[model samples]
Target: MLPYLRRLIRDEDALLQYSAQIRGLTAGDIYIGSYFSVAANWLPQIIQAFQQAYPAVHVHIEECANKVMYDGLEEGRFDCCITTWRPFSGDWIPLCEDEMVMWLPENHPLARAEVYPLKQLCHESFIEPLPQQDTDVVRILKEEHISYETRYTAIDNYTTYRMVEAGLGVSMNNRLMTAQWQGRVAILPMDPPHTITIGIAIPSRDGASPAVKKFIHYVQQGISQILAPR
Candidate 1:
């Protein structure tokens, strides 16, 4: 056998012995890709708890917009993804469901309304992330034939919130994104109450590594706790 191949086999054997002796994992690596909103709102808390349970594990997170998250997952760049939309196939596990809301400037006319209808905002200037590419918001708007003026196109949620705060325009967002900017923006529940189910998309439950499985369970538990009855 080649010297390199022999050395690699020897190293693998040593690693197995070392792992058996320690009774602790030596390599616990996982990659997660998800929207920035999920990363900003919930990931830190979840990671803190996860690390406490498995100190040896290493987690790498990629924060992109929704479409990027999905693309990364399909490309095998990520072990799993957290997103509002579910995979069309049967491999996904549902985590949580949240209602969508309209985010408007504090002084905007719709701020005083209990609920904002999509049709009413047709003429209002809209601030959204990159249409179709970055997010699915544009598709919904276009499907409804809601004519809107694009005031600004932000790259991420923070920038979107900043633009809204500056009274640049109104926008629609999920509860996860809107919750963080609650006091700064006027959050009005949408009419007919559009809801998005957020969940983890993995390759397959049976094919997941131990670390990945643990993290998925942790996420589900954390979300359940958050949504539990008060």
Candidate 2:
């Protein structure tokens, strides 16, 4: 009789209630994915502003390289990513465009030049960020038959900056990252200027979580405010 009673007393309502509570607890969590290099420049301000705006929301930030960030976004591991290099998929939002500039030690010959031509700069020792795939700079060098020697290769912008600063080699980087190191390194604008597109990538099938959406909005607004005519 006791065994039969246990089988008949199914607490389906209670089970559903427990599941609902679990889902509710997770609903407000936001997971953001981005490359360490770009994040190094923009994330601190973005996160601080976001936390101030929404103190209740839990923010999970995953910092990785560009390729890993893209892969994680595609695999549903992250809510979104802020990246300069866009994936082939069409689900990203265009945030901003930043010009790529050449970084050299202050004492380098061309460091004093207002703008350096790509062809001429290609003759010197170069330090390039090793992207997972061919980048625009690599394509340019190949197309133009430029034969610059690669002194060092780094996986992140910070390391590249340090290398260039140490006089190990010269490299090209986006303006946003270079902006923070103004006096530390000499940034020469590239002639026939090159620019890279930076943007946020989110899943197309489902809308981002409320917190994630708010953060994205914050980033877009913050960047616009900073870059707008002053």
Candidate 3:
């Protein structure tokens, strides 16, 4: 416990020094952790614009699973994180809403339906992505009491998409993640119409580095403007 306390003290000291540097608004590094799909779909433009505004303040992003990202933020390994809202002990503010949609083979019988039956998931072979993790997709299935048959477990979203395209199974994913991908899979909204709010999570705003607060505020405003009804 002595060593752990010493390490904590050192970390605190370093954070204070870093915070001072960022408060000057001249330069400092801010580390951000994010979930894979959120980073792929939402972070590029935000990071680019942030750098343009604060060129000397370097931003480092580390992408991992949702649970890991949340844990990292709590442990002080990340100044902030971008991910879906979950039962996390962190500060989360909504950025945008992403619809959860089903991906089925274009030639599949259910593909013709206007909206896929939510209960029909039990009858289809399901492609589970990131089986080891409790993502929004998996949580939705459990909450809805949908016991799906896992025909295949994919390591990532693209793999799951390909599996559905090949008729191996159907899978659900956030629509924004596949916006740029064109494939033989049919993306359809579910009967119940599920949606997840993607957001920024930070340990807390109090005592946070200036860079961290600036980035979060800028991202919030930017996304709000983009999503505002035109």
TM-score of each: 0.83, 0.77, 0.87
Best by lDDT: 3
Tens-digit lDDT track of model 3 for 126-230: 898888667888888888988789889987789889999999989998888797799999999998889998888877766566677788887887777667899
Off by over 4 Å in 3: 1-23
Better of 2 and 3 by lDDT: 3
lDDT (Cα, tens digit) per residue for candidate 1, span 1-230: 35456445434544554563378563556788876767888888988999998777788999876777676665556678887664444267878777778888899987989899998776788887756564657756766777788877877777787788888889887878755655568888987567777788766776666677788888888878777899
Colliding pairs, model 3: none
Could you give me the TM-score of model 2 versus the true structure?
0.77
User: In candidate 1, residue 74 scores what lDDT?
Assistant: 59
User: Considering only N, C-alpha and C atoms within 3 Å, which residue pairs clash in candidate 1?
Assistant: none
The local distance difference test score of each candidate is: 0.74, 0.70, 0.80
Model 1 spans > 4 angstroms off: 1-26, 86-90
Could you give the C-alpha RMSD of every candidate to the true structure, in order shown? Answer: 5.6, 8.8, 2.8
Report residue 149 deviation for candidate 2 (angstroms).
2.6
Best model number under TM-score = 3
